[model samples]
Target: MATTTKDRLIEATAELFRHQGYSATGVKEIVDAARAPFGSMYHFFPGGKEELGAATIRWSGAMYGELIEIFYADTSDPVAATRQFFEAAADTVRDTDYTDACPIATVALEVASTSDPLRRATADVFESWLVQLDAHFARNGLTKTQARSLSVSLFCLLEGAFLLARATREHRHIRAAGRTAAAAVRDALEHRASTVARRR
Candidate 1:
């Protein structure tokens, strides 16, 4: 399928936003990178950059959320899959020279206080991710409470590790965080399994 002009704009914007953040990336740069006409930005996004920013956030957020599904779906051993997922994240950061990490975290931090609309967009993306993670854990035998809590913890761990890893230019932070998260996941699963056994 050919990339539509609208898709190109979103993809280009997402790429720029992921690397340099929303404020640093200019409209010209977005168009140049996208190979899109200057007028197309307004034509596709009538409200301009802020509108485009929100769209990028939602699009990138959904794309990352799909990655979670790829990792954890239809698995007999979600715990192991969780470990592999984090390790792969570490690998990606390293491979990208630390420029590529979470798609929305940078913008979320940037616009959290300044832009109410952007802030809400980020919040929505985050909750969507949590929903996917929570469902994955819940299906793997964790109780609802346990799944939600673990979902938040794992989310926090990854985001924090990505921040640190990018700052230090060290991918090891993500790798170590992955190890720690895998342990937490394993512990939760084991505890849940034991409790259910006791009930049985």
Candidate 2:
């Protein structure tokens, strides 16, 4: 299927943002990378750069969330899924020479201090990811509270690990984070099972 111009714009901007952050990525670069006309950018996004940036963040978040869903669907065990997801993430970074990680984190940190619109956009993306992870845990046999907390921890571990891995140009941090996150998920699930059994 042929991709739309707006979709291309979002993807190109996202790639630029992931590499150089919000302040560094410009409309001309995005359009050029997207192979889109300059007028199309304004036509699609009347609110201009901020609007396009926010939309791009949301688009990337949703796309990445689908990847999480794919990993979860591939295995019934959420712990295994978690491990697999992180392993793939770490491998990708190593394969890409540590240039690729989360699409939103770099821009999130950079825009958090400068643009309210962009910061909110990034926050919305993170929150959406957290919600999806929490729901996956809950469906696989975790209490709501347990799922939410564990989701937060797992995401924080991943995000923090990315920073460390990028800084060190090593996959050790992310691999360790994956192991730790999987263990935590396992422990949480076991605790929930035990509590439910005692209640029964």
Model 1 agreement with the true structure over 42-139: per-residue lDDT tens digits? 99999999999999999999999889989988787877988899999999999999988999999999999999999999999999998998888888
lDDT score of residue 29 within candidate 2: 95
Model 1 TM-score relative to the real fold: 0.96
Residue 6, model 2: Cα distance from true site in angstroms? 1.7
Candidate 2, residues 94-139, lDDT tens digits: the string is 9988878999999898889889998998999899988988888888
Candidate 1 global CA lDDT score: 0.94
Model 2: lDDT to the true structure: 0.91
lDDT of 2 at 22: 85
